[model samples]
Target: MDALMAAFVAAALAQVGDRPAWLAAILADRYRAPGLVIAMAALALLGAGLLAAAAGAVLAPRLTPEAKQLFLALALLFHGGGALFPVKAPERLDRWRIGAAATSLAGLFILAFGDGVQFVVLALAARADLPWLAAAGATLGSLAVIVPAAVLGERGWTALPLVPMRRIIGALFVVAALWLGLDALRLI
Candidate 1:
C-alpha cells in the first residue's frame, strides 16, 4: 500500500504540465474522440508503467537500501530538472489514418515510453518489492492527470501556472534528493 501510494503521488506530481496531458488535449481536439484518446492513453501509460516496474523488480534485489535511496534521489533530481525545463511535444497527428483509437495508442505509447512517471515507477518499485501495485498506481496517477486534460483542454491547462508549478515540483524533488542522499550516507 505504501508502495502504491508512493508511486501514485510521485507519478501524478511528475505528470503535471507534462507532454502526456498536452498530447491528450491535442488528440481530443484533432480526433473529436475524447473517450478513445483517454482510454488509449491510459492503456499506453499502463504498458509503460508495467515495463518500468518489471525492470525495477529486476534491479531491486541487487540494490542495498542505501543504494536504493541514492538511486531514488538521483531519479527525483533528474525528473524534477526535466520538468522545470520541458521540451515541446511532437507535432500533433492531424490525420488519424489508422482510426482515432489506434493512432492514439501508438502515438501515446511512443511518446509516453520515456516519461518521468515511468522512471519514477521504476525507482519506486526498485525501492519496494511490489512491482504490480506500483505499476497500477502509476497508471492511475497518469490517468488522473491526463483524463482532465483530455476533457478540458486549454481551459484547464492554460489556466494553470505551468512554469511556476514545474519549478515548485522541481524544488520539491531536489529537497527529496538531498534528504535521501543524506540518509543514504548516514549523515542525516
Candidate 2:
C-alpha cells in the first residue's frame, strides 16, 4: 500500500503539465470534438496502462533480479531511443467518416506510445507489484490534466499557449527518458 501510494504520487506528479498536456494540445489542434476526443484519449490510456499492469503483475513473482534489471534496461533503451526520434505528426482528424471518437483513440494510442509518463507509470507499477492500482492511478492522473487542457485548447490556441508548452514538455520528456535509462542501466 505504501509502495502503491508512492508510485501513484510519483506518477501523478510526473504527468502534470507534460505529456498529458501536450497530447491535449495536439488533439485540440487536430480535432473538432473536444469532449469525445478527451474520452477516447482517456480510454486508450486506461487500456494501455491496464495491459502494462497485468503484464507486471503476472511477471513480478517469476523474474529474477538480473531478469528484472534486463527488462528495465530494455524498456529504458527503447523509450530513450524513441525520445530521440519522434514520430511524424499525425494527420488531422477526419471529422466525418471516423468522427471524433476514432480519431481520439488513434491520437491517444500514438501519444501514449511515445509518452514518458506512460512508461514511468508502467515501470513503477511493475516494480511495486501493484499493477491494477498503479494503472488506475496513472489513468486518472493522466485524464485529470488532459481533459482540462482539451477543454481549454478547444477555446483557442491562445487559450492554452500550447506551442511553448509543447516545447517545454518535449524537453522534459527527453530529460526523464535519459534519467530513466541511466537509472535502469545503473549508470546514474
Candidate 3:
C-alpha cells in the first residue's frame, strides 16, 4: 500500500548515516557475531516500529485529516533536517551485566526509540490508518541498512558514502515536507 511504501522509503533514507547503522557496526565488530547482532537489531527495530505505529493509531481518530497531514509534514521536516548533520558513533554498552545478546537487544531498542525513522513511521501510520503495515515497512527498511552495516563491520561500513547520501535524502525530505505542509494548509 502507499503507506507501507512511503514509510519504507522514508525510514531507509533517514537511516543512511544515522546512529543506528553506526551502532550496528560497532556491535558487530565487538561481538564478532554479526548474525546475533543483526537479529537483535531487527527485533529492536520491530519493537520500536510497533510502538510508533501504536502511538500513531491512537492519534488517528482524534485528529482531523489536515491536522494529521500537518503533523506528518512536521515529522518529515524534523527528520530531514536532522539527517543533514553528521552522527557521532555511539558508545558500546560495555557496562551492561547481560551478555552480548541481551546487551545488543536492549541497546538497539533504546537507540531506536524516538529515532527519526520511528517518527516517520508514526506519522505514516496515523495518516494511512494502517498501523501494522507501516510498522512492518519501517522495520524492514531499518534492516536493509543495518544488515549491511553489521555484515561489513566498522571499517567497511565507513567506506560507504553515507554523508552524501544523508545530505541528499535530507534535502529531498525537506522539499517533500514543504510541499506537503502547503497542501495540508490548502495553500497550493
Candidate 4:
C-alpha cells in the first residue's frame, strides 16, 4: 500500500545511525543475547509505532491539508536539525536489577518514546488515510535498523561511519522539509 511503503521508507532512513540503533547494539553486547535484544527491541518499536499511528489517525482528520503538510515539514525540520547536531545518548542505564529482555524492553521503549523515527512514523501516518498500515510499516522499518545491530554485534556497529551518515540523512531531511514547507505555503 502507498501508506505502508511511505511509512516504511521514511522510518527506516530516519533511524539509520540513530540512538536507538546504537542502544540496541549496546544491549546486544551487554546481554550476550542478540536474539533476545532484537525481540525486545521489536516489541518496543511495534508498540511505539502503533501509538504514533493511532495519534496520527486521530489528529489528521482535524488538520487542514496545509496544516498537515506544514506540521510534517516542521517535524522533519526539527528532527533533521537535531540529527545534524548529533546529541550524545545517555552513557548508561541502570540495568542491575533488570534481566536482559526487561532491560532491552524498558530502555528501548523509553528511549524511542519521542525519537525521530517515531515522529517520522507519526508524520507519515498523519499524511496517510491508512494509518494502521503506516504503523505496521514503521515497525518493520525500525527493525530494519535494529535487527542488524543485534545480529552483527559491536564490530559491525563501529564499522559504520555513523556521524557522516547522520549528517547526510539530516541534510536529506532538511531538503525534504524545505520542499514540503514551501508547497504547504503554496509557494512551490
Candidate 5:
C-alpha cells in the first residue's frame, strides 16, 4: 500500500546519522554484542512505531481526508526542518546496572520516542487509515538502517556521508510536504 511504502522509505531516509543509529553503533562497540544491539534496536523501533501508529489511528475517523492531508503535510514539514539540524551525540549509559541487552532496549526506546520518524509514521497512518501496516513498514525500514550501524560499530558508522544523505532526504521531505500542502488547500 502507499501508506506502507511511504512510511518505510521516509523512516529509512530520516534515520540516517540519527541519534538512534549512533546509539546502536555505540552499544554494539561497547558491548561487543552486535546481535544483541540489533535485536534491541528492532524491538525499540517496533514499539515506537506501534505507539505512533495507534495514536494516528485514533485520530483517523475524526478528521476529513483533506484535514488528514493537512496534518500529514505539517508533520512532514516538521520532520524536514528538524532533519536540517545536526543531531546531538548519543549519551553513554555506563551507569545502568542492567545487562547490555536491557540497557540497549531501554536506551533505544527512549531515544526513539517522539522523534521525527515517529511523527511521520503517525501522519502516514492517519492519512491512509492503515495503522498496523504503517507501523510494520516503519519498523522494517528502521531496521534496514540500524542493522548496519550495529554491525559496523562506531568507527565504521562514522565513515558514512550521513550529513549529505540527511540533507537530501530533508529536501525531499520538504518537497513532498509542499506538494501535499498545496493539494490539501485545493490550490494545485
Candidate 6:
C-alpha cells in the first residue's frame, strides 16, 4: 500500500508538472475563453484518468515483472523521442466567431490527446495498486497544474516562463521512465 501510494504521488507530480500546462496556457490564450477551455481540458484529463484507473484495475495483476519493464521502457522511449523531437505546433484556434464552440471543443480534444502528461498519468495509474486513489490524485494534480496555467494564460503569456518549466518537467519524465524501467527489470 505504501509503495503504491508513493508511486501514485510520484507519478501524479510528474504528470502535473509536465508540458501539458504550457500547452493548456497556449490553448487558453488562443481560444480566448480560458474558463471554458480549461474546464474542457480538465474534463478530458479526468476521463482519461478514469479509463487508466479502470485499465489498471483490470490489467495490473496479470502483468509480469518483465512485461511491466518492457512497457515502461517502451513508453519512456516513445515519449522521450516525442519531446526531444517535438512536432510543429498546431494552428491557432478559430475564435473569431461565436459559432466556433464546436471547433474549440475539437481543438481541445486534439490538444488533450497529444498531451504526454495525460498519457503518463494514465500509464502510471494503470500500474498503481489503488486505482481509485491514484486516479483521483492524478486528476486533482493535473487540475492543480492546469488551472494555474489557464489563469496565468488569461492574464498574459508573460505571466509565466513556460519554456524552462517544460524542459524541467521533461527531464523529470525521463528520469521517472528510467527509474520505472529499472525497477521493472529488477535492476533497482
CA lDDT of every candidate: 0.83, 0.61, 0.89, 0.83, 0.89, 0.59
Give per-model TM-scores.
Answer: 0.93, 0.62, 0.96, 0.93, 0.96, 0.69
- What total of clashing residue pairs does each candidate reach? 0, 0, 0, 0, 0, 0
lDDT of 1: 0.83
lDDT of 4 by residue, 67-136 (tens): 9899889888988888898658644465446789888998888877768777777877888978888888
Candidate 3 worst ten-residue window by lDDT: 87-96
Error of 1 at 95 (Å): 5.3
Error of 5 at 78 (Å): 0.6
State residue 3's C-alpha deviation in candidate 3, in Å: 1.8
**TM-score, prediction 4:** 0.93
Candidate 5 on 133-169: residue-level lDDT in tens? Answer: 8888888888888999989998999899998888888
> After TM-score superposition, what is the CA distance of residue 32 in candidate 1 from its true location, in Å?
1.2
Candidate 5 versus the native: TM-score? 0.96
Residue-by-residue lDDT tens digits, candidate 3, 1-188? 87888888888888898888888888899899999999999899999999999999998999899998999999999999998888877877767789878988989998899588888888899988568888899888888999999999989998999999899999999999999999999999
Runs in model 2 deviating more than 4 A are 2-20, 29-32, 65-91, 94-96, 154-188
Please give the lDDT score for candidate 3.
Answer: 0.89
lDDT of 5: 0.89
Per-residue alpha-carbon lDDT of model 2 for 3-38, expressed as tens digits?
A: 356445544544444555555656766665677777
1-188 in candidate 6: lDDT tens per residue? 43245434544444443455555676677667778767776676666666666766676778875775566565555555455443344455545354334544555556555555445544555566666665566556666677777777734543555445545655665776788777777898
